[model samples]
Target: MLDWLRFGLGTLLMLGGLFVLVTAVLGQFRFRSALNRIHAAALVDTLGILLMLGGLILLAGWSVVSLKLVLVIAFLWLTSPVSSHLLGKLAVTLTDHPEREMQVDDPSLTRDVKEGD
Candidate 1:
């Protein structure tokens, strides 16, 4: 009975992750702005990987494999947001008008972005 419950929970988590990833992919195409696309990519990197890995960990049942999965999740959690922020910054930097892609609260950034910095 416990085994069945574990399997079911794992499957559900994996499915939810897959669904999040698929929607993010769709959002990438739907959004015209690079910043929007980056947001979608971030969602895939974070929530999608997290859910799928969590399910894998549950399925692995506290083994060495599960520990490795947890490590992978931790590594990704540390790296994904930084990468996403960099990508968004690059998008804003490269665009002719960063204000169009995203709001520049800092006057310094607004000036730099307008100048294509």
Candidate 2:
């Protein structure tokens, strides 16, 4: 009974993660801007990955592998946003009229940051 429960919950979590990842990919194609696509991709980087790793950890149970999965989740949680921020900044730096899309107070601010002054 307990094993069945674990399998069921793990399967559901994995499927949910796959669904989120697929949706994010579809959203990237559906959205028509770099920032919009990046925003969609970030969903996969965070929630989708978490769900998948959580499912694996559940299946692995109390073990070294599960501990590693937990560590991966923590690392991803720590890094995903920073990477997303850098990507967004890159988009803002490269794209024309990015302030309209990103709601930046001034696009020139991105330039000033890049020039190191």
Candidate 3:
């Protein structure tokens, strides 16, 4: 029946979200640099959140709860990336670690202008 299909899909989505969240946490500890950590955080923000939202939507069916759930998901999707960018920028600006190397190839991080002509 439709109910069984919904339950199965919801369960799968929730499990996938949890898996992504665990990997993100592990990645934070395993990675050497802030940039790498940011990448892992982004994975959690995108995949983990999306999967969880999908699960919630399936569980709620077409109710008002599902509508609110979608709004929350949209807000998170918008804010998470912006917050990550700000945190990464702050880390790069404030930290003074010699061993810290950029793992993500950000053009802004690499682009430098010469002063003298």
> Using lDDT as the measure, what is the rank order of every candidate, best first?
1, 2, 3
The TM-score measured for candidate 3 stands at 0.82
- Model 3 residue 32 CA deviation (Å) reads 2.7
Residue-wise lDDT of candidate 1 within 1-117, one digit each (tens)?
999999999999999999999989998899889888998789676999999999998898989999999999999999989989888778776677766666667868666655764
Q: Write one digit per residue (lDDT tens) for candidate 3, span 1-117.
A: 999999999999999999999999999999887777988888676889999999989988999999999998899989989999777666665555423475435544433211111
The lDDT, on a scale of 0 to 1, for candidate 1 is 0.86
- For candidate 2, the clash count comes to 0
Candidate 2: residue 91 Cα off by (Å): 0.7
Residue range 1-117, candidate 2, lDDT tens digits: 999999899999999999999999899899988889988998676999999999999899889999999999999999988998888778766776665665667657866756652
Query: Ten residues in a row with the worst lDDT in model 3?
Result: 108-117
CA error at residue 114 for candidate 2, angstroms: 8.7
Ranking by TM-score: 1, 2, 3
TM-score of each: 0.85, 0.83, 0.82
Clashing pairs in 1: none
Superposed model 2: Cα runs more than 4 Å off: 99-117
Best by TM-score: 1
Query: What 10-residue stretch in candidate 2 is worst by lDDT?
Result: 108-117
